[model samples]
Every structure is written in C-alpha cells, then in structure tokens.
Target chain A: MERVPVLKIGDILLVSIQIDMEDQTALQLQEDLADRIVETGCHGVIIDISALDIVDSFVGRTLATIASISRVLDAETVVVGMRPAVAITLVELGLSLPGIRTALNVELGMALLARERDFEFKDIDDDEDDADEAVVAAS
Target chain B: MALSTDEVGRFAGLLESNGDALTTAWTDAVATLLRGRLSHAELHRQIAELQKGFQSALAGGAGDLEADAAGELRGLLSELSNTRARQGFSATETAVSIFALKEAMLTVLGQDGDINATTLRDYVSFSAFVDRAGLFTFDSYVRAREELISDQAEQLLELSTPVVKLWEGVVAVPLVGTLDSARAQVVMERLLQTLVDTGSPYAIIDITGVPAVDTQVAQHILKTVVAARLMGADCIISGIRPQIAQTIVALGIEFGDIATKASLADALRHVLRKADVNAGRRGAGRRES
Candidate 1:
C-alpha cells in the first residue's frame, strides 16, 4: 500500500522515487501523477530516479507511460538523476523511453524546464507583437 | 606394475649419480628443439634442480611414480613449462626437456651392466612415467600461453576505448581497430562514465580509425547512442567514410534517429553550433539582467 509522494514546487511537480517500486505501486503512481498534474495544473514534472538501481521493462514502460500522460495534461516531463548502470540496462532492454526528456540531476532538470518556460513565454510575446503590428496596419 | 622399494632406490641412486650426464642430455635435446637459441647454462641449472628434486622425492615416497612422491616433480615441471612459455618456447620444445631426461636416465641404467627382465620392466615403467610427465608439461604450457594471450587482449581493449573531453560540455571517443562485442561494451561503459563525469551534453564518437562498418558494428553503435541518449546526452557518430556509408545502406541497417557526420571536423562543427546556442542563451540572459 506504499505510494510515491509527489511534491509541487510553484507550478512544477517533483517526484523523487527513493525506493524500489512494486508493479502495483508503479501503476498506482502513474494514476496519482496524472491526477496531480490536472489538479495542480503544473507546467513541468521532474521524476528523479537516481536512487533506482535496476529498471526492469515493467518499470521502464511505466515511466514512459507517465511521461506520455503528463504531455497530454499540458505538462512537460523531465526524467532526471538516472544512474549510468540503469541507463545501460534500459537501452539493453530496448526501452529507450523515446518521448521522455531527461537531465543529469534535479537542478539541471529545473533549469531545462525553466528554459522551456522562457521559450513558451517568448512565443506568446511574439504572437502578441505580431497582433499589435496587424492592428496598426489595419488602422 | 609397481616397482619394489629396492628398484625405486636403485633408480633414485642412478639419478643422483648421473645428474650431470642427465642434465647434459636434456640440454642437448632442448638445443635440438630450440635450435640452440636458449642459454645452455640456464638450461643446465634448471635440469640440475629438477633432477635433485625428483631423486629426493622418489627416495622418500612410495615406489610408484603416481604417488605423492611425484608432487615435487609436477611442481618442477609446471614451473619449467611456465618459464618456457614466457620465454617463447614451443610446447614440443618444453616436453622434450622431460622426455630427454628419461632417455638419458635409461642410458645410465643400461650402463650399470644389468640386463634382466625386472630392470627392463622398471625401465619401461620409467619411460611411461616420463611420457606422462612430458604430456603434463605440454598441457601446462598451453594453459599458460592461453592466459598470456587473454591478458594481452584485455590490455588492448582497455587501451583502445579512451574517452576524452574535447570541450567543457563535449566528450569524444576515438575508436580504432575492429568493433567486436567485447570492445563495444568497453566503449559504451567508458563513454557513458565519461559523459556522467564531465556532465557533457554532447558526445562525438569518432570512428575514423575503425577499419570497416558492418551490420553488427552498426548495431553496436546504435546501442551506444541510445544508451547515451537515455543518460540525457546526445551522441553524434562521426568518421563515416564513403565505403562505410555504402556498406550501411547495402546491409539495410538503420542507425535510427542518431546524427552521423562524414568526419570529426564536421561533427565538431555540429557540436559547436549547439554549444553556441547554449552560449547565446546565457549571453541573452545576462544582457536582460
């Protein structure tokens, strides 16, 4: 009945899985993270798996599923703190987690998310600037 | 077919008395096999020590060569085989040393002026014992040589897969020689460790020194790229020669979405572009601040 705790920092949800996950627990986590993403309307999620020593296919798939679901919820997911051994194993298992963004650590993960947020803001500003130019042209 | 204590004692005494003659014959045989390449004095010294050990052990233990008495002889033979292997002697040359001692011992026994069935039986058993010892030496020499070969191979592997940091946020692994599975594993582990240690976002795998790129090699390269990608660092495979590109296409091996370049220079230019983007971002942030 153990659950992975999800913490919210500003609009970012941080999930540091400190223990090995049971199959049921991993499934439960997928649900919990999705619900939290909607409830908090977070802009980014950083799932830290540095403490995870072994990532079997089941856990790898669960991670990929979580990243995909978070994307659908309008939140960017950055999986961070993967040990080198785990990364090698995940590749050998042929589960590259293609859609998930990854970073070296939580700090870098946060920086990446902030950079992404900056790009999003700049995109919105560009749209506004174009709208202003159009209004002036029409007048 | 066990020799009585009396016969074993007589054989031991013969070995002790004719030790120099036996050493001479043994060296002569080894000289034939080695084409006189080895130092005669060193060969003589080794044979003298082996004869001393063999005679003493035969006198102390039971008459049978198969008993624990031959343990010392086995040890001597093992050491001799190991030395010969390291000294570049062939298996036949090493076994000749023991077999030659057997022949020289028989000649000494014949000169003792005893032409009887029991002595001849003892001689035959002794000859068989020496043959067994020669075979044991040959086995040890082969094993030692194999160990030496494998050790050299491991050192070569460690030498070939060196990951170096080219810039602050970039590392490169220049591969040479063939890309077998074992070397591929080493390359992947070393490159991944370097990526983690440097925290470099870019890795350039230069395969210019690689002789050819077959399907299996392409698979290994792709696996390494995927592994690096999972670790959050992108990999750029460089050194794609025209022949290798044609081979890859002919084999229908897909490199997936990983980036490839024709040369290291092109790969470096690609990394610099990305590095410039990052640098430009930091500069923009500073300007705004």
Candidate 2:
C-alpha cells in the first residue's frame, strides 16, 4: 500500500499515512514527506493517521522521528485523528510519542495552527509598533 | 529351551535361594575390575585406554558380550554425568532464588537478614508455594519482591494524608516523602480524581514531607496543576521547604500562573474566602429570583 499521501491545503500541507506501518516504504514515505515539508515552506504539517488500526512500536517510533524532523524544518507537525483502540494499544505497549502534539481531528489541528500563526504575527506587529514609537520619541 | 511346569518352579526356587550369593559374586567381579593395584600413572593410563577401547568398540557395534558390556558402561556413565550436571544447576538456581526471597522479605519488613515462622509463612503465601517442597521458583521470588515493595510504597503513600475538604469548593492534600516520578504521578492522579469527584474548584498541595525536590518532580507538579486547571480547578501549592525552594530557584523553574501560599492554613483560608464570595453572590441571585 502507499504508506504516505501528501496533500497541500491552502498554505498548510497534509500528510496522511496508513496502518500496520513497519516497512522500508514507511521510512521512505516519512523521508519524502519531511523533504517536501522543508521544500514547500508550508505553514504547518498535519499527520493524519485515521485509517490505522494498531500503532505498534515501529510505527510509533517512526511517527516520533517524523515529528522531530518536522520541528527542525520549522514546521509544526500535529498528529490528528487517532482511534481509541490505537491509543489504548500504544499505552498498553508503553509507547509514548513525547515532544509531539496530538489533536482529535484535522479541523482542530488546523485551527490550532492558525491561532499560533495569528499570535506570532500579533507579536511581530507589536514589536514593529514599539520600534516606530521609539523612533518617534528619539526624533 | 523347553521346561515342564515342575522344572520351571524348581528353577525359580533355586534362583531365589542363590540371589544373595549371585549378587556378592557380581560385586566381587566388578570390584576386581575397578581395583587399583598399580602405580597411579599406570592406572590412569589403563583407564584412558579402556575408555578409548570402549568408545571404538561401541562405534563398531555391539557384536559380542564384552563389547556390549563396555558400551553399556559408557552409556551409564554419560547418563549419570548429565543427571549430576542438571542436579547441580537446579541446586544453584534454588539457592539464588532463596537468597533473593530473603532479601525481598527483609526489604518488606524493613529489616536485615531476620527470618521467623510468620514471616516465612507470609513469604510463602505471598509467593504461593505449590507443594510441601518449600521451593519457590526464581520468577516467583522476583514477583513477590516487587509486590512487597509496591505494598510498602502504597502504605507510605496512604500514611501521608487523605484529601481534606476545607470548604464547599476547596480540598487540601498534604504530600510527603521524596517524590520520585512514580510517586509524583500517583499523587497527581489521586488529587485530580478527588477534585473531580468532589466537584471542587480549588486544591491545595502541601509539600511538607518532601525531603528533596528535583526538576522532574517539579515538572510533574507543574503538569498536574496544568491538567487540573484545564479541568476548571485552581491548584495552590504550600509548605515549600527552604531546601526545596532553594533547589527550585537554583534550577530556574518558572512557577508563572500557579498560586503559592506560605502554609496549608493560608491556602485553605484563601480558597474558603473565595468560595464565600461566590456563595454570597449566589445568595444575592437567589434573593433577586
């Protein structure tokens, strides 16, 4: 099966991967997605794994690796739409995806990204305003 | 050969009567074969040669009585050696298991190398002995040790304090002990669940019994407060010992939005006053209704 599917939504890129993910194809897909994320300069990356039935050790490790790589590329990666069974299985196996953000669905993840972007732009505007006031005061 | 019934009966009686004599003769013959009258080196060489001859004769086939006997002796010796090796391994494993169990018992009782009948019975019951052999397997010993440790930890945790309701919407938990990550997590869950169950709006965690606090424990406490706030509860921390405060300052941890009080009583008073204000507001609303 095609392990990863990359789709661009507005300025955000959505990367959807399949279940039972433990093969060379999965690794290659992750690498390809990471490269694409870096190249496109997308605002955010949504890792959709809604089709996964079980999240085993290998798949959990791979997802965590991808999340880390995405961070280095300056793109926030949010894992979205995990099934309850998959979550329970991961907990039972003592597998944790530390340093990775998770959301219940893609909509919430996208909304969260938008909010963060808004906050960043607001900080930039505030800084610009402060710089302008400082210049005026010096004059 | 062929024999009548009367002849067969007579032969059986004769064999029974001569059994002791036959056994003695057999023993003598074996002793003679095993006797060492020559020099030690010569005897060793003879035994080595005999072993080699027996090996070769067995490899050839058991075609004669002497060769068959030699092969049987070699087989019997090998079997005995294997049995002895297995017995030795079993004995060593048993000894190690017993030692581990003893250590586990001592740890549980908070003693060293003291064993009594009651303790032994408790250990056996906790270990679930299968039979009267008084043998507990290594796996069972390890499991029992873990259980004993967990039980002791749980007892220590329970002795710290139960969640006390100070006001209608506030509860307090006094935490003690060196909060390792595991114990910190347990405290977090217990406090959160109590808040949820009591529908309290505020929780005060007094860290009086905490001997030392590290970054991990601090982070755990922060996480718990954050989670509780997410569930619409305010967490107040009190009883910050000087050492813990020094450590926290040294580590440069940010408390930020969490409320801190000097003592549990102060924290409870703060929460109760807030609850009273809310209650007054509710009473005014009822009067207006």
What docking class should model 1 receive?
acceptable
lDDT of each: 0.82, 0.59
TM-score of model number 2: 0.37
lDDT of 1: 0.82
Q: Tell me each candidate's TM-score.
A: 0.89, 0.37
Cα lDDT tens digits for candidate 1, A1-139: 7898888776688998988889999999999999888876777889999889988989888989999999889899999878878888888787878788998778778877877766667535534321111111100
Report the number of the highest-lDDT candidate: 1
TM-score of each candidate's B chain against the true B chain: 0.89, 0.50
For each of the candidates, the C-alpha root-mean-square deviation to the true structure, in angstroms, is 6.4, 21.3
Interface RMSD in angstroms for candidate 1: 1.6
DockQ-derived CAPRI band for the predicted complex in model 2: incorrect
DockQ of each: 0.43, 0.03
Off by over 4 Å in 2: A1-139, B1-140, B279-289
Candidate 1 lDDT over B1-289, as tens digits, reads 5666777787787777887777787667766767777778877788788787778777875465567877788888899999999999888888888888776776677776877997788788777767777898899999999999999999999888889889888899999999999899889888988887777889999999999998888888888888888878889999988988888999999887788999998999999998776655544455443
Error in Å for residue B221 of model 2: 1.0
